[model samples]
Target: MSASCPISRDSESIKKLVDNNIGGVVAKTISITPALVPRPSIAIVDRGLGRFYVLNTVKPGEIRVESTDHLNVRFIYSILNAESWSDISFEHYLEREYPIAIKYCRENNVRFFASIGYKPEELSILGPRVEKIGVDAIEFSTHYIGRDYKPIVDSAKALRESVSIPIFAKISPFTPNISELVRELEKIGVDGIVATNTIGPALSIDVETGLPILGGSYGYGWMSGPALKPLSLAIVAEIARNTKLPVIGVGGIVRGVDVIEYFMVGASAVQLCSIALIEGPGVFKRILSEVEYWLKTHGYSSILDIKGISLKYLKPEPRRTWSTPPVVDEKKCIGCGFCQQVCVYDAVKIDLIGNKRIASIDQTKCYGCGLCTTICPTRAIRFLEQDLFI
Candidate 1:
């Protein structure tokens, strides 16, 4: 260092020159304040979205969107679609079908009850195995052959003696004295009674071919669905009036309304078959959903609250005096002779010359079953209830 000559000032001048040169050589970079990025899409999720996405369109604290506890209805899966007494083995069908139904019930938390219809010796094979599944109950199909109550009572007794699980007897509606059968079943310590199997070894005939659909004299089959509700209700009400054992009603149940109807008639629970066959296994979920919706809408907390509620208003009127047979409106009649062909009582006769079918109501023979109303092509027949009219 020869001399110290204001190097600090010179250094400041150099820095200024460098800054000016940089500014002139290139455009000055703008100071970049961090920009606020648009907020990411907020996804509002619901608890029910775990299985399927349930949108939160429904408001919280909304009474219409309230959750309901499921009803305690036992689902019994029958192996056969219709009654077939051919080479069909109930055990074989049970072995193949029961596992599928059991898996479904387990996954859904639904109770499954297996029904065995064979003789005591035949059902004995399944006894040990079924006892291990811890099913709700093992029901013995008592209506396999007919309305004879002796065999059913004996079977129930045998089953109860053999297994620790509860035994239920499924009986037919065609029994002359259903109350007697129920009383006998209760006396023998039966756990429950499933009232009414599908009506008939019913046959249907194709008049043109004069042959049965399933290869028999009578080709017609038992009517199910909405048509059998009234009959089921009557039987359930009758049994409820007489017996103390829990009655499980089965017939023509399609919807939650039908279930409620059966409950009102004093059924502890109701079973569905035709609806399940027509719709599928998923029909059970739909029925439960609708039932829960109905219960909540009606301000009912539990299904027990509505059971037998209709019976209180039910007044018994004299059968002969209050019930009347089908009356055909001649004005609406088309002379198709469908009514004459359908009458089981043979009460309708057609005048070939007049081209008119006349219905004579035989009070002694007409049990007011209303089979005629179903087959009438023209909506001419109407049942007049004397009590309701009064």
Candidate 2:
């Protein structure tokens, strides 16, 4: 957890998350001084519209995981938040926050990780103090650090020198030469990596007033949620393929299938923040139950059974030179004519089979675009070449 999550801000809030059935928690990123956060700091964007929910009036414990029904993916689900670092001072965390987290996490057998910032001076001060407090590990955020990357490497080196426990570098997706960066961190003795912070200083504006929704200067804020999944998946795969260090995936995870996808691409574990902000602490319990049910039903004893399974399937270039058209399964086709609407090449056609309708592809006109295969409501259209997988 980083900015804007109250659960990571203080001991009491942290306890709520601990009570949920989760194995670990990363405290919000703390700094030397509390941040002067802007008002109206958070906004939820759905399908090109911005919504402001009265989350404060509803107590955290009382809030259910209902808003994120299937991860709020029915629309273009995303969050634009201008939140800064932890509002509480670093000294306060040392005195009260860290101790409370450590105690509760200890009682619950949950691993607690302290996420610190990139200031070299601050790292020198905060790293040892939190380490001495007996945190399982330390995660240093590289979010605010610029594109140069030298400062991040330097700070990681200094932090590695200061702490005895594992040091996880939480890297931003925007960082250049990400694979090279993770290798450098590994060389410097950083223990592991957290792939992807939120994507972009993104923007969302109110159509009614023509004003920015978020309160940050110029109303720019980082975006996190379902929209971040595809980009995060590629980056996590890249980092995992590049380094031996355990990679923890964060960004757009709300379902058990999402966790399974991360593991397939090589995530040792995942962090849920954007979903938690909307779903509250109960989100953890809901997601864990889903994951357990899925694992058991799929006949997997553990997540380790599928870890990094997709890596071996990666091909640098296409194996086939020619494009193959998709086949239509007449039995499964509902004949909704939806596929015909999406086929840009005018390749799909609806035919009346007895009293029912079915979709058929004109192989010559298809051009193997594959749009119909994906857009088909039923599992009717598929590539003939994909039969091997079945």
Task: List clashing residue pairs in candidate 1.
Answer: 203-218, 203-219, 203-220, 204-218, 204-219, 204-220
lDDT, candidate 1, residue 16? 28
Off by over 4 Å in 1: 1-82, 85-100, 143-147, 207-210, 216-220, 318-390
Compared with the true structure, what per-residue lDDT tens digits does model 1 show for residues 1-390?
A: 000001101223213222221110000100112112222201111123211111121332332211222333323211112222223243443455345545544455445455554455544555555666545567666435554667777777667777777777776667668788788888878888776665655544345887554433233344445556687788888888878788888777777777888888888977665564445445666777667777887789988888888776667763355445677767555555666777777777655436554555566666566777766544567776553345
Q: What lDDT score is found at residue 249 in candidate 2?
A: 87
The lDDT, on a scale of 0 to 1, for candidate 1 is 0.54
* Residue range with the least summed lDDT across 10 consecutive positions in model 1: 23-32
Collision count for each candidate, in order: 6, 0
- Top of the candidates by lDDT: 2
TM-score of 1: 0.57
